[model samples]
Target: MNAIQALTYANIAIWLGIGAYCFFLAKKQSEMDRRLNSLILQSKTENDA
Candidate 1:
């Protein structure tokens, strides 16, 4: 393969790895948000009682 093609392939691979990391980070953030919301709702219910 040519040098330019190899360089492009490398760039694509790097982007793929970065995209995967971003996806997992977003998922983790979503989970944390859900847990936080649940905790807040629980507290509100407990306080109301």
Candidate 2:
């Protein structure tokens, strides 16, 4: 392949990798947020009791 074609493919691959990483991070963050919210509610309930 020519230099231009190789560079184009490399750029596309890099962007795809970045997008996948961002998606993974977003999923983890949402999971952590849910866990934190549940813990906060549990604490509040215990204090009320």
Candidate 3:
């Protein structure tokens, strides 16, 4: 492939990698939020008792 074609492919690959990384981070954040909410609920329940 020519230099321009190679650069295009490289750019596309980099964007895809970045998108995948962002998706992974978002999933992890949501999972952490769920766990934190659960802990908060448990604490509130314990306090009420």
Candidate 4:
């Protein structure tokens, strides 16, 4: 393959890698948010008792 074709494939691979990383980070953040919300609710309930 020519240089341009190699570069194009490399660019696409880099973008796909970045997209996968972002998706992983988003899933982690969502899990953390759910845990935090449950903790807040638990604390509120404890204080009321």
Candidate 5:
């Protein structure tokens, strides 16, 4: 392959890797938000009781 093609492939691979990492982080953040909301609800219930 030519140098230009190799560079293009490398750039695409880097972008794909970054996209996958961002997806993973988003999933983790969603889970954390869910857990935090659950905890807040529990705290409010306890306070009300």
Candidate 6:
């Protein structure tokens, strides 16, 4: 392949990697938020009792 084709491929790979990283990070943050919310509710229940 030519230089331009190679460059385009490199750019595509970089963007793909970035997208995967962002998606994983977003999933992790959502999981953490859910866990935190559950913990808060549990604490509140304990306090009520």
Predicted model with the maximum TM-score: 1
Clashing residue pair totals per candidate (backbone < 3 A): 0, 0, 0, 0, 0, 0
Which is better, 1 or 4, measured by TM-score? 1
Where in model 1 is the C-alpha error above 4 Å? none
TM-scores of the models, in the order given: 0.87, 0.78, 0.81, 0.81, 0.81, 0.84
Error of 2 at 30 (Å): 0.8
The local distance difference test score of each candidate is 0.99, 1.00, 1.00, 1.00, 1.00, 1.00
Q: Give a tens-digit lDDT track for model 1, residues 3-37.
A: 99999999999999999999999999999999999
Report lDDT (Cα) of residue 8, candidate 1. 98
lDDT tens digits, residues 1-49, model 2?
9999999999999999999999999999999999999999999999999
Error of 4 at 39 (Å): 0.3
How many residue pairs of model 1 clash at the backbone? 0
Task: Give candidate 6's error at residue 5 in angstroms.
Answer: 2.2
Residue 11 displacement in candidate 1 (angstroms): 0.2
Per-residue lDDT of candidate 4, residues 3-31 (tens digit) = 99999999999999999999999999999
What global local distance difference test value does model 4 have? Answer: 1.00
User: In model 2, where is the ten-residue run with the lowest total lDDT?
Assistant: 1-10
* C-alpha positional error of residue 11 in candidate 5 after TM-score superposition, expressed in Å: 0.8
RMSD after Cα superposition, model 5? 1.2
Q: Write the per-residue lDDT of candidate 6 for residues 1-49, one digit (tens) a residue.
A: 9999999999999999999999999999999999999999999999999
Per-residue accuracy of model 3 over 1-49 as CA lDDT, tens digit each? 9999999999999999999999999999999999999999999999999
